[model samples]
Target: MTAVKIIKVLGTSEESWEDAAQAAVEEASQTVDDIHGVEVEDWTANVEGGAITSYKATVEIAFPVHESSGDA
Candidate 1:
């Protein structure tokens, strides 16, 4: 049997929304393993002086759940 866990996280980048999403996955991978996929929930940006300053991305990260085996 196999199971997966989904987690929501926000990533920000000064470049683009795609970069932001990639950043989220990269950061999550540091702590979590077996990263299967990612879903982009939303995208937003901050504007200053009529220019896009930063891009933000809301993403759901998916990874497999590992079960521990015990010896009896």
Candidate 2:
């Protein structure tokens, strides 16, 4: 049997939405492990004065659940 878990993360990039997604995954690697995959949940772009400014994306980060043996 395998355990699984889901988490939500927001990634922002000045270049493109793809970069933002990659950034989120890269940053998440510092705390998360056993990454399964990322799914794009919601996405939106920032615009001002009728001009595109930036991209914002919301993604779901899925991974296997792990139990820690650390004591509190």
Span of ten consecutive residues with least summed lDDT in model 1: 63-72
lDDT (CA) per prediction: 0.95, 0.84
Candidate 1 structure, TM-score to reference = 0.91
Q: Where does model 1 exceed 4 Å of error?
A: none
Best candidate (score: lDDT): 1
Q: What is the TM-score of each candidate against the true structure?
A: 0.91, 0.84
Off by over 4 Å in 2: 68-72
lDDT of 1 at 46: 100
For candidate 2, lDDT tens digit of each residue in 1-72?
Answer: 778888888888878888888878888888998899999888778888997688777889899877777887
State residue 31's C-alpha deviation in candidate 1, in Å: 0.2
For all the candidates, what are their Cα RMSDs to the real structure?
1.8, 1.8
